[model samples]
Target: MSDALGYASPQHYPAVVTDRWGRVETTLVNDGTAFGMILRGNRFEGKSVDGLALVGPPVGSNPPTLCDGDLCSCTIEWRMPIEVSLDGAGPSRVSLSAHLVLGDPTPNRGIDSVGVTLTLHLPTGVVATTTPQELIENALLDLQRLLPDGTRLLACISCAFSDYSPAGTAFIGSMACFRDRKDAYRAVSGKRDMYDIWSAMSGVVQETYHCPDFARRRPGSGYRG
Candidate 1:
């Protein structure tokens, strides 16, 4: 009933949680930075069936409300601790985890959980340049670990730069999606620009080179590209 947090639904981008009564709450706790969320309503009494709990402000007729039901609402607050670091100047992976506290009086439902991953766009100065061959070779190395056996490398169509940071040192580019992580790795290896030379070249090069290697190698053995 209360549109304070808006309509709740599982939409892409910021993770959203909605109740059966049309109350919506959106959370972006996956960022590499620390953040917190607090929702006060009369509908949140205990933990939801899905293990989600309602926090409370205590001592009031207008408790945290979940729906139209006459149940006392509670306050639910979540604090997410994020850690971020750049492996190179290209793309970086972020891992997130958090502790959720529901209700203040009894501290009923509290738990620790892992959130989603947040991809951060790094500056260009942080990334190193590589040739087409090198890019493909690196991609192949990453794909060998992500893809299952028998997966083959396919054509990698590069995309153009849609936006660039103000400093002009870095540019944001897009690429065609691969069938799987393995497919993505393979596609990244090949050089083929989609829009312009710069974007295509950068996208293909980055994608191919950024994947993590997961293959088992013998002592003194080098990567097979």
Candidate 2:
């Protein structure tokens, strides 16, 4: 949020936001660059902010009104710094970008359906490792592969990263009951312990995750060593 970051003044600037699902939204940053950073950084604060993206609305305009179709059809772009530790080899820094679309294209009454496009950029020599190979091997029960690219993988519903990382993953889709922004707001501000929130998200892959795929070690899943 530094002016050095090439951001415009708050009163006249629109901030780009990315949600956990990788959905990008542009909204008028109320205060200024610093304030915008607060909003983006505190995404857990509510539905409006699960994360922030590189997309934004025009300057001086209110946040765009997204229609059901917009949320359903929007493909979000996300970038994050990740550490991928393969077996016990070591942890490598990787750039993770997940292209996530919100809702079910074909709603399945009780089951939420989501489409995901994943792009992973590993370090210079990391691609040669079998880590990527293992990641696709130990997938979830419902995971279905649609395409594969060296280190990049894609699935219709979601994929798993347990084989390589020895850690479980989460798949969050945008369903009506699950996608409620209001509900997300309640989560971040509720009386729930911060650790509990983190624990809940960090636990073994649960049914809540449904969007673009992400990987993390599940509690009590056992050590990679």
Angstrom error of the Cα, residue 51, model 1: value is: 9.6
Tell me the deviation in Å of residue 142 in model 2. Answer: 11
Give per-residue CA lDDT, model 1, range 123-223, as digits (tens): 32221222211122233334333333332222121111111122222111122222223322333322232122232222211111122222222322211
> Residue by residue across 32-82, what tens digits does model 2's lDDT show?
111123222222111122122323432222232233212322344444333
> Candidate 1 at 204: error in angstroms?
30
| lDDT, residue 90, candidate 1 | 32
